[model samples]
Target: MTRPLTVALVAGGALLARRALRRRIGASPLWPMPALEEPVSGRRRENRRPSSHRVLVAERTEPAEGVVRLRLEGADLPPWEPGAHIDVVLPSGAVRQYSLCGDPDDRGAYTIATRVLEGGRGGSRELRERLHEGTEMEIRGPRNRFPLVAAPSYLFVAGGIGITPLLPMVRAAERAGADWRLMYCGRSRASMPFLDELEQAGADGGRVTVVAEDESGPPGLAFLGGLPAETAVYCCGPEGLMDAVSGALGEARAPHLERFTASAAVPGGAFALELRRSGRVLTVPADRSVLSVVRDELPNVSYSCTQGFCGTCRQRVLEGEIDHRDELLTDAEREDSMLICVSRCRGGRLVLDL
Candidate 1:
């Protein structure tokens, strides 16, 4: 069952369409990818303590070069939607987010994959070097920011390991019999994970287009602007690729984006922060993040990704207006809480439930 049930099944002389999509991860060549954080875009949230579950790494395999897929088995595991991501708490207490590239129908286990970033942060390197089968770890959230919506048609663009999140979306789109096209890009065909499965999915027609850099110079995105107004476009990959797709779309439409890293926030004015419980007041400089200033006051503040996508630095706002910046939180979440990493205060002062 490690091979995701991407293909549909027929029974009783009728077609049985499953709602869950076949999730897969492809490890591509050594692309200059900084962070493979899940697609945390169009994120909606409600304030709740997302529970953490204990799981054991039941199996490990190399789906492609520079990639490792881990099947974590846990009894009565929670179900996840397409484009959902789980937060892994490493042995070093470093938290990293990864997309769930497994059959959501199989709730007993969860599958995720990662690409080793040799020159970047140690999160992926730790997963590759330190983790193995039989190892126990903790996972959190199963939160979905990049959810597949009901669209007239879909145009999915994935680059390198960025295909992780879109895998489930592609599956769901096919199952729904929606008009969808996928442009999967990577370093080479040999390095792309789940190529055979994708090829098979699109075998009946030309639904999937593979763009290997070695074979194709670069992806031509001018056609995106020519798409129909009803087409829902989704793009996940390197910042430059996503930016290019956005650029091509121009004023026609804004494609739903899944980012590996956090987006840069505009520079806002400095403000004073009052930690209610800690009885501390700090000034958040315009140039620095609120997290940097808060950490100085309380050295052990729990935070990861420091870019606001992870929501680790979220603090309840007791008073004052917030200059919200992160894409991970929703409108309701902005009512009482704010991600201290990038968000700031609209007023000159504020009170926080730290």
Candidate 2:
């Protein structure tokens, strides 16, 4: 008489079962595959060594009241998509990224525009005042992570300078003969760049809506309810506008978002990090970053932006859980490495393969 407790499978069968289970787990969609490179601002860094090229400002003009447009020309310049951006190495060693707004087919030059922010970082002001026509500057990249995906219809939301990236997508959609609509909002008509162009596109009963805050205040969120079920939505704007759009769409159909702004740091206690090869330990304070502390020990380590947007400060994590705060690394990359500029330790002690 066989009992249920005494039943057993053959060793070979048990081994096959385990292997099949592993295969199924690996095939799961939730299982993250390693990204070839880190993604920044809804775009990924390509799996290639970056090279810098000198570009001349062929033309510069005030497209709007406080917005400046620049046509940067370089020899054999790489083409870019609507949502692609390039890093400009400023004269003062400050690196800033700007979206390519011009025609992608035009390989000789790239067009970019920036709105001056009086109360924000000085990069915009510096570019507006110092960089003139014929000014030569070094630039890196033309990466796109906010690429437009095919769908039956589309919705785009742009706020002020955020329109730079979406402008190209609109053109692409128009050329494809796809149904699309745009909700462009700004403080005023005079301050909005490309107002004339966008206005002209919507003139013959087109699908464009311009909401100037001075005239209509904040646009009502009721339009979100009327979107087609299969419409692909893209939004690049202020946090408030993005948040509102997200809330309206809900988790079921959230729009693809592009952010030039970094999210606020997570509130947590300070921690310590150990550099394995250097045999050095440093206490990271809440007020500072691991990059800053690490620089104190290894001053020559390369870093750029220092805001976790650029993958320049990525480091290997040998041991310990990470409190990832950057919008860069994917889950697979997070398993063994971290962007030291923004991420912190989930535990009290961290071991870095420095």
Candidate 3:
């Protein structure tokens, strides 16, 4: 009886030791467990993916007659690349994205230029009319979709307010001693923001052309025709100009365009969107945005920029087709999913991954 009891005790001790060893091995870095073993509680997990920062208005300057350059002061500003934009959450909770035109090397602050649109939405209007220096506002991201790609040479074209994103890229190119040229166009010099800086940067006899419509008439299609085959053309501007450029370029010489407005005028239609996880289907009116519909139906959903510039309200498409109107998603992403903020269903019915 004593031998049997001793044998059982030894077997039990070995089993416990083995379990401890297994636990230690699992906890080891070599095993590598996920940071969160379980799903984070609530929609906070989704909300946390897109980070937000607060910035104080440091200064405001009128670089041009209609353009207002805003300098924001914040130590916690996220590291951003050239061509990055931040979503500014205004006093009325309206979110709008502005390109970071400031020098990327300048860690002190981020700067953006806004052209007040008389008939446009309230975001830019509020900044122009109501907001001022020392005003505190919430800003999310230095998110960049229009990143500078490595090329042998570059051809940059800007129209009016579109120069904002390209400014940093131009500076970076200058710093790197890369081969590049810029064609900046506006109504006139007075309406062109950062004209002095642009002129000074090109003073070393760098290839930079200024085309004021009032002075030089509309920039001819020939301006783009002069680009070398080895050059990558990066353009940002109004729809008509972009469309003209797009029409002129062949497959071999297509200019990479960054559109300021995410949405174009699509035919108005009513649609039903099915949220898979939420198990809700909401009707989206022709006039209302998908973000409004989603937020109304599912109160827990989080969104920052409803204009589709920020990837905050991005959702996967499970079924049906989408008319993508967002700038954040790449061609592949747009093909795969939809930005619920601005994009809508095409076929009257759509399914989404909540």
Candidate 2 weakest ten by summed lDDT: 1-10
Model 1 per-residue lDDT tens digits across residues 1-354: 012112122332122222121111111110112345465475633356457899999999999889899999997678777888888988888888888887777888998988888997789999998889999999887877787765456788899888888888888677656667788888888778777888799776578888888886788887776676666789999999999999999976799888988786777888899999999999888898888898998989889877766777888888899888786775656787989888889999989887
Q: Model 1: what TM-score?
A: 0.85
Q: Tell me which of candidates 1 and 3 scores higher on lDDT.
A: 1
Q: Each prediction's TM-score against the native?
A: 0.85, 0.80, 0.76
Instruction: For model 1, state the Cα shift of residue 101 in Å.
Output: 1.3
lDDT of 3 by residue, 78-129 (tens): 7777778888888987778899999766787999989998888767888997
Global lDDT of each candidate: 0.78, 0.77, 0.74
Top model number, lDDT: 1
The TM-score of candidate 3 is: 0.76
Which parts of model 2 are misplaced by more than 4 Å? 1-49, 269-272, 285-287, 316-323, 327-337, 346-353
Candidate 1 error regions (>4 Å)? 1-47
| Clashing pairs in model 2, backbone N/Cα/C closer than 3 A | 43-145
- lDDT-based ranking: 1, 2, 3
The better candidate by TM-score, 1 or 2, is: 1
